[model samples]
Target: MKSTEYITVTQLCTQYKVTSQWFHKLHDTGLIHITTVEEQPCVSLQAIHQVDKIMRLHQELHVNAEGIDIILNLLEKIDTLQLEMNSLKSRLNIYDTEQ
Candidate 1:
């Protein structure tokens, strides 16, 4: 992966004003994926957005890690379903145009 594609754990914690413990907790719970570079932990840039969302759910909504996990899973499912729905609609449109 490109170096630009991931951010160091230290950078994430510093920017987000969260602790290393928080990062470890998220990683341990499988809420975020961490890659090691030169024996240092790094997080994907894509996963940063998810971490932000999780932080909001925890800080603003007072959701626990388990609750956040469930919410994220549900959100992912909804996104997947929406994509499938859009694909099916596009296929239907093609058929309609053919008719």
Candidate 2:
């Protein structure tokens, strides 16, 4: 599979050994994101990464789908907060230089 190109739902499920219902559930819970290709759902490399992380957590931590969702959400929130913090720090430094 091409790393840069998006894959169909079937390809994702086959590659990950999951079912369509499972994939859609993951998407609905925000644990993974999907793209549309010619009216069919497609998954990206980024989505594959997210799903891989979720799968690892599920296997290693014995987490259920709900737990996986919570973990992924927190991880995403942390990433967002970190970016916001960095932006604020940059702005503060600019202000400090003028003062």
Candidate 3:
């Protein structure tokens, strides 16, 4: 991957005012992914928004890592369900228009 596509963990920590331990907790709980780049750990740019949300949840809401993991899983499931619902509605509309 390109260096431009990932931000160093230290940069993220400094930007978000979070500790490396927080990043490690999120990584260990499978909330965020970390990879070593040039001997420095980094996270994908795509994950930055999620990292921001995680930080907000932890720093603002006082949610623990495990709780954040569960919350994220539930949110993902809801997103999937909403997409399925939209697809089903579109399919049903197609059938309705045929009548």
Candidate 4:
């Protein structure tokens, strides 16, 4: 594939031999994040590395996809809540400034 700024869906699919459905499902399930350029979905290098690690763990440890999905979902939820907490703290700081 070309070394463009962003990797296209076709390039990712072709390189990994994964179907589009699986790719999108993984993205939606929070197992991977894709970069978009000009409204086109592209693969991020960081996400590719994470996907590779997940694949290795599955292969080496015989972990099922369902288990991986659950773990990733929990991690994403934790990240979301952490960000929310930071926002709430900032809002409280604003109130403190007024008081």
Instruction: Tell me, by lDDT, which candidate is best.
Output: 3
lDDT of each: 0.88, 0.80, 0.93, 0.72
How much lDDT does candidate 4 score? 0.72
Q: What is the TM-score of each candidate against the true structure?
A: 0.71, 0.61, 0.85, 0.51
Clashes of each: 0, 0, 0, 0
Q: Candidate 1 on 1-99: residue-level lDDT in tens?
A: 677888999998888788888888888899998899767889988887788898899888988788899999999999999999999999999989997
* 2 against 4, candidate with superior lDDT: 2
Candidate achieving higher TM-score, 1 or 3: 3
The collision pairs in model 4 are: none
lDDT of 2 by residue, 1-99 (tens): 453578788886787677888878877877777777777788886666777788788767888788998877898899999999999999999999998
lDDT of 2: 0.80
Better of 1 and 3 by lDDT: 3
lDDT of 1: 0.88
Give the poorly placed runs of model 1, Cα more than 4 Å off. 80-99
Q: Ten-residue segment with the worst summed lDDT in candidate 4?
A: 1-10
Q: Provide the lDDT at 60 for model 3.
A: 94
Q: Comparing candidate 1 with candidate 4, which one achieves the higher lDDT? A: 1
Error of 4 at 41 (Å): 1.3
In angstroms, how far off is 32's CA in candidate 2?
1.3
